[model samples]
Target: LSMPKGYAMLGRGILTIEGVLTFCSPQLNFVQMLEDHAFGAMIKDFDALKEFRQIGNRLLGALSKSMDIPSEIADVLKMTVRGQTKINLGITEAAEPLNAVNKMVDKLVIGIIDAALLISSSLICTTDMSPKIFEIPVLGMMGYFAALVVGIWLLNGIIRKK
Candidate 1:
């Protein structure tokens, strides 16, 4: 998909290259938008700082559970071993694989974006949809429920040996 300026979508075909998670590098404009908008910045800043600590905890949890990778990574080898376990385990298990897992550093990053995208698109499609519906005051957060279902499926797949 070509953009109005010059940017284009990265690829079309399902990538067969194992361990090379094939997400298109997130466009710079997305970060630019986050930086430019006050609400966006505040939302991202607050959420990311919160998620950052949670991510550290999760990483430690994963490291403790890993067998093949050394938990105590040396400084030099740190970058090399950083994601070896997740990619190996994640792609084989996670439903969306590359886009949903590896490229996303924090769970909240994907969660927030996925929810935002869903709400935004839903709003666009149904202009009459109250913002409350996205917030799910009446429908009781079906979006959140859907996300929970997907998240459960992903975690269940990862935690279980197939």
Candidate 2:
């Protein structure tokens, strides 16, 4: 039989060209390259096509306006557009209290650690250890400062939450 010059051959040729374009420019979409160069060149009446699209849109709009759309159908269309928004709102609301509780628990844990650090640092300061900063143990002083900073940060976070 003669070489097939049907849709199968046409589709194969299109796929081959698209694959080559994709290989050459991995960053760009193959279909877009075909549209821009191959298919774009083939479109000799883009203006006519655009005009036809506008006319089709106008006709559809007119038909829709003339038709009586039921409330249930209208609601379904609205739901399609706003479905994601509804889902997002539900998730955010669900996570809101959990986020607050998580932060509260975190602050409680940090507060406990800070209290332990303060007690240990004070005990260290009482000892006559070497490397003293104005008769106070340097390590103890550093620990006290760190605990104070962390306490202040925790307090700031609590205040901001309120």
What does each candidate score in C-alpha RMSD?
A: 30.9, 14.9
Q: TM-scores of the models, in the given order?
A: 0.20, 0.41
Q: What range of 10 consecutive residues in model 1 has the weakest lDDT sum?
A: 10-19
Question: In angstroms, how far off is 95's CA in candidate 1?
Answer: 19
Candidate 2 weakest ten by summed lDDT: 84-93
> Over the stretch 5-112, how does candidate 2's per-residue lDDT look in tens digits?
797788898788778877897776766765688766767646887889999999999888767567757877888887733433345466778988887888899999
What lDDT score is found at residue 52 in candidate 1? 91
Q: Write down the lDDT that model 1 would get.
A: 0.55
Candidate 1 C-alpha lDDT tens digits along 1-162: 646432222222212221133344433344344347977667666876678999999998987778545644553377566754433343465666756666445555656766775575555544444556534443435555666676775566556734
Angstrom error at residue 16, model 1: 52
Candidate 2 has a TM-score of: 0.41
